[model samples]
Target: MDWMPAEKAIEDVRVIAAPEPRASADLEAQLARALSLRWEEVVLSIGRTQMLSTSRTGLSLAQRDRLVRDVSVAILTQIDIFLERKSDRFTFQTLLEELADEERTSVASKVGAAIADVEMEKSGFRFRANARELTFEQFEATQSKNIPDFVYDSGRGDETTPSDVVAVEAKGSLSRLRATKSRLKNLAKKAYEAQVQAFVGSTANDSIAVTGGCAIAFGATPGNGDCTLRLYVSAPAGGTDSGGAGAAVRGPGLGGARIPRSLSSAANAMQQLDKKHEIERESATLDPQANGNGPGHHRPGRKRRRGPNAHGRIAFANYETVFRLCGAANAALMLRQCLDGAVEREDNPVMQAFYQSSSDDRFLFGGTPFAKCWSPSGYFAIYKPAAEAILEALAANRSTPPDSVTLPELPKDLSWEHGAFAAQADGLTWMSMVRGDFTTKIWNLSSGKW
Candidate 1:
């Protein structure tokens, strides 16, 4: 494993500053479109319940059903399709005990990842794309190198000017044995190095912007104690590399910002995650083709352009690292309709507009870091697939949805009622659910916060 002394960890890993107003507004608009697209897709899900989604799934519904059927017959067990839906929601003994050890382990992993995602959003980073969705070939081409979990929108470029993005790698660990802050420090530093190697692609940005990755880990379901978090901002690929790990340390409020002994809860998370851009050297070097089409090619960053000391080259480093800890997408998902009929479930028109506006079509959905329902105030998809188009529709078009981008019926009852799930950077903080019914049926994912 990579090695970084305790003193260096304190000096190097740090939080980023908040995004500029323009970038924030840009992301907000993109987020609105993304959430709007989800509304449309969910409506379609209602329509195609019988159909099997053959797209991005671990198992087809039919396959799963067949597997269940085989297993049930072999064991003389009845397959109750509605067992989950019909089961007692108020079953006190089965709050989470129903899961097997392995299942719990898997869930614990996701929960840790989800909490990390929540922390990043709470800190102000925007998810752009998920690397896992892409194929190996596609991965190397469209996504950033080193395969950081998700790329942030970068909020820097436009149709004319290609912008850069910050590629982040998520670090999630189940603290099985007695782990210490010293150990996690090296992991964070290692993540920083991964971020350094990442080259932003997708024809959006030429060079990367800001440090990625934040160093934070979560306790496993059976683990003990709070985890440490060092939100490090590393020297980006295009940015100037700090001479070494011993460079000067800086952050949004470096002198004032107190490094947390551990990110024990949401209360400790920074209000607005903003960071200064100290990378040196300017200009996005274009590829030989220079057509601005396809995954445009470009060379790696040149020699270290004297940037700030903190944003320098170090042994272990980069993120959408505790940026921490964690984070994480798709399309007309095709479907096999009933009655042996092949239905072309038309893709969302609103999404079509958004996709049409996008230069890269690899992304199917917006990057949402947290689980189904973990955002403190709740979270929404924020990647801007159709940013410019949506802006135009809202501004000039006379129609309610601008003719091309009609929105779905607003969502309802998506939030938890008292005992859903509350999380922090460390892990799933708590779970509660007195009743399963949602009486309010309110649509919380509106325009602004989304």
Candidate 2:
């Protein structure tokens, strides 16, 4: 190992981030239909990316089907909320404060992500690639424990060079008002994770040499039982947190791809996490006692099978895992059922073609056996390549590439302006028409090889 001078042991990564995007005011039916289609498109695309005929990609056909079912249902549930409540975001935000820890974390995740995209664009950055898909070796350099949610280029450069870029992460909480403000203060620590990702991306792109900034947005309470959102950009260079003067974070620290970061940066980040955890525990409901139970503690029903997580390393269910547990026939049937449940018309060719994909589960799913684990390799395959591929295909068909068209790309995509698919009962309304549906029939994956 090469020795580094003592004075320069730590590398510092920092960024400027902020934003808020307004939700679109589309009618309930239009929103339901758009979100439903998006939910389907995203799920199918992810499964396709994860497997794509395993002989070609080597993923379990059954696992792909299972993932499509599990992940699609989870995404649909969130989209359904908008349909039922219309645009009353506050209702959802306050109710969020009352959810169980698992559910709250889930909701906060989606909300934080939406906020991060807006914050980055509002500060002038165009989407590049998702940092979550980058390998951990990249993150190791920054010495951060978390991953940045997304990466973006400023798009201000000429054809000869790429724009300045930044890694951005979203931090959020729906805890009670007091806790919300406290949580936001410490959210700064999470930004360095983004900085690390941006740093790595820059290394891959030949050190185009652009500055980076962190984006943090969290629920804030200025009134009783009321929740307003906020975005924060850390005070420049002086990363002097409330209690510590770890070091002054400055400059891009460009061209030092091999440099080691100071231990203080990692320490401060963890310290901030511990402090935030303590704040969340301010109420009795947040954490029950017993540190003595220790790190590997397990409580009854404590572990949950969250469908898929970008950060998960623990092996959960993947398509191949599910296919092996449930024989090909049953697995295929499960896929058929879920796909049928989501169908609105008998003539919707795209929906029809997916379920009628293939007879052989190996071929039916896709063949990337090694990539079948529901980890960063498969579950996390949801972003980057798949979205880019679809958008690229879409761009080729249109005169103006989507990357150039500056509209509210998000909720707008889920609105009437985006057009709709024909269905007797639009969206999940059709999903409900079939009572005792196949979606509720959980194919237990626990009875198989772990």
Candidate 3:
């Protein structure tokens, strides 16, 4: 059995920085510095008492800088403790649990404030009241806490001034485990209500005032936490800001925001989500030939499966490695779905060939790796039929296939070539392409076979 090193456990983490105001440029900088604590010595605090303790070690200078940057006291301490305990070598799943623990408090606030500020600056808007003391009663009675995250209006009194306005509450953390659904639900509700309050207060008398939208993010999940960061967003609601709580914004609930931790590490996961939703929604309105089309490509319909044996098992590594090499549609995905359907349905040639061909290095290793199958030519034969079918469908320029033809089934291997198209300089095994059909172009990373 292969052993994974502790450092490789997390691989990397992608955190969305809460947006902060351009005006708070000074405050943000200070806050970032203060939290990063690069300048300050690590001090242990217990309630009102502060003590300098050197016992808590294992923090590298870079690690300390990151702690300062994340502005998370709890996470830093936890990480230090992790190193001290050597818990970093725990299973990947366990590491996520640890991360969740680290992000419960200060990290949340820091992330929230930063996000709020960036959004404000981006839209040339300002928080009506930031961290402004609002007594529970004052917040409720003044109804000032119900504002939407953002607001846009035609004009208040001055016609020359831009009416566009925005408000966003940024939240972040390093916690791996997530708050309970009930708790998160309640938080979302309160936050939404607060957003509405902000919305009304800002729009006040303006008839054209509009609440842009809202967002949320944390290290926790609606999805399995494999250190996969996800985001969710909603379109700005236009029209007059109706008095009372504006319609509550909805989120993906549990499964959404699959952002990897590479680019935009500091961007609020929510912002990434909002941007994605925006793209999807906009694409829905466009014609296939429009300049801005959704992931416009055709594929054969999803194939039905009978059982696991009916479809052959696939090594996850091989799937991923091949996809990287193919540089087209998801190589791994195509393999799994096709194999699953073949096995389940007990298709004679496909299933037999799949099982036979999948032996050797492919089965021994996980996912799609660089290893070749027992029979490359035979494997190609089974794969080619599907590939040709897919090409034919794409060439036909169809979005959804007709009921007559079966859809492409999920690949037997769960691996994907998604990150495989990245620049060679990126130095990662996975390649990533920003725009293109990642599944179709099967460029082999090893032999540079296209």
Candidate 4:
């Protein structure tokens, strides 16, 4: 017969770990006495049962049986309690219901209310707000991971520059209260990972804070357990448990982009949406400083002329000046409020159309792409000559004598097909045939050849 070593039996096997195991003072006293005795004597008494072994270290048969029974009961009781606590979370079906309702009310309501409030303003601002509800319904539409009770967004106005947004979550108890508290403490570690996977795909914006602080208000219901509500707020810059330091936000870092195995594809789609806007904001910031050659039209602090002919000239230049059209320094400042007093619309289909089509070509006419671009050649094509051509056409339409006009030409060696594809790691490829030319490329290039 196979046998386990006595030492192995004692390995990491503590009898006092459970509360009940240590509950009986009488049993503890007996255990202490047993431990205090010499090992050989105790072993002889329990194992080889001779007169010498029994004389000073023996127990009567009834006493031995009673001790074993009590200890076993304590151990089993403790195990049962642990198991019960572990299985205490809400049912998946119930959780889903709560999450769906919360999203419809809490997050979705906030977005709709904000959009409506902006539209009712009487100012001379021009703002278009796209209030989207990233509900369990939408998540289900993507057929990705179970919907998280959080959301993200981007906003802009004629008076202010575009920026990102993050919202709260109401995930019904994934872990128990004690367990969740512990997990929350360690959530800062996810900040870096969240930044990359959440924001990098959405044109490299902030990891759109999908889940954050929640303000839960408990109701007066009897059988609902202890329904204590809480308002969990996000730390200003301290980040979540799994988040890294602020360094992750400096630029696109490798650590930020690592996708954990636990992530679902649905979350990935949401992230891409965020990236599209980030690219737009970055591209908008690239507009040139001035529009004329007059010496009086120089940038804010640069050397320029104030015509001695009694013409007082003041010029605003660069992104700092242009960005003020949206708002102050706060990126999340509502777009409508920034637009002084103009037309405002919620779910502005016109603006949405612009966003949908222009996001990928943000640098069009600018001389370069944003630093975060994944495609170098494509960036050059749109931001350089393509932009110049469009600007020339606009100039020709607006004025009889165009200031300076130049037409864009396709590179002689590069065909339409060459401009439309991308290759990634693994053999996963993406192709676009929208415009006559068929372009295809792999999605990821790190794994191997495509």
TM-score top scorer: 2
lDDT of 4: 0.22
Ordered from best to worst TM-score, the candidate numbers read 2, 1, 3, 4
Q: Tell me the spans in candidate 4 whose CA falls farther than 4 Å from its real position.
A: 1-143, 150-158, 173-450
* Model 2 C-alpha lDDT per residue in residues 1-450, reported as the tens digit of each score: 011110111111232222111111111101000011122232322232222122122345556556544543453354334221332222242444455777766655554454444434333343333443233444455543455554455443332333444455566555564335445545655454344324432332223332453555545331233333333332323222323433232223311111144656644654775576355334213112111112211123333111111111000112222232223343333322222233223232121111111211111111232233322121111111122222222222122111111111121122211122111100100110111212112222112110
Give the per-residue lDDT digits (tens) of candidate 3, residues 1-450.
012222212212221222221211111111111011110111111100100011122554335333432333343344344321322221123343344443435544443343333323222221122222111332445533342322211111121233332333444443434443434444544564455323322322222222333333323331243322222223223321223333222122211122222334434544674586356334432112201111322222423221111000111212222222232323333332332232123232121112112222111111232213211100111133333323232223222221111112223342323222111110111211122311322322212122
lDDT by residue (tens digit), candidate 1, 49-71: 11111112356544533442233
TM-score of each model, in listed order: 0.37, 0.38, 0.26, 0.18
Candidate 2 off by > 4 Å:
1-69, 72-98, 121-124, 132-144, 177-179, 193-202, 205-210, 220-227, 232-450
- Residue 264, candidate 4: Cα error in Å is 44
lDDT of 2: 0.30
Candidate 1 vs candidate 3: the TM-score winner is 1
RMSD of each predicted structure: 17.1, 22.3, 21.6, 31.4
lDDT of each: 0.27, 0.30, 0.26, 0.22
Order of all candidates by lDDT, from best down to worst?
2, 1, 3, 4
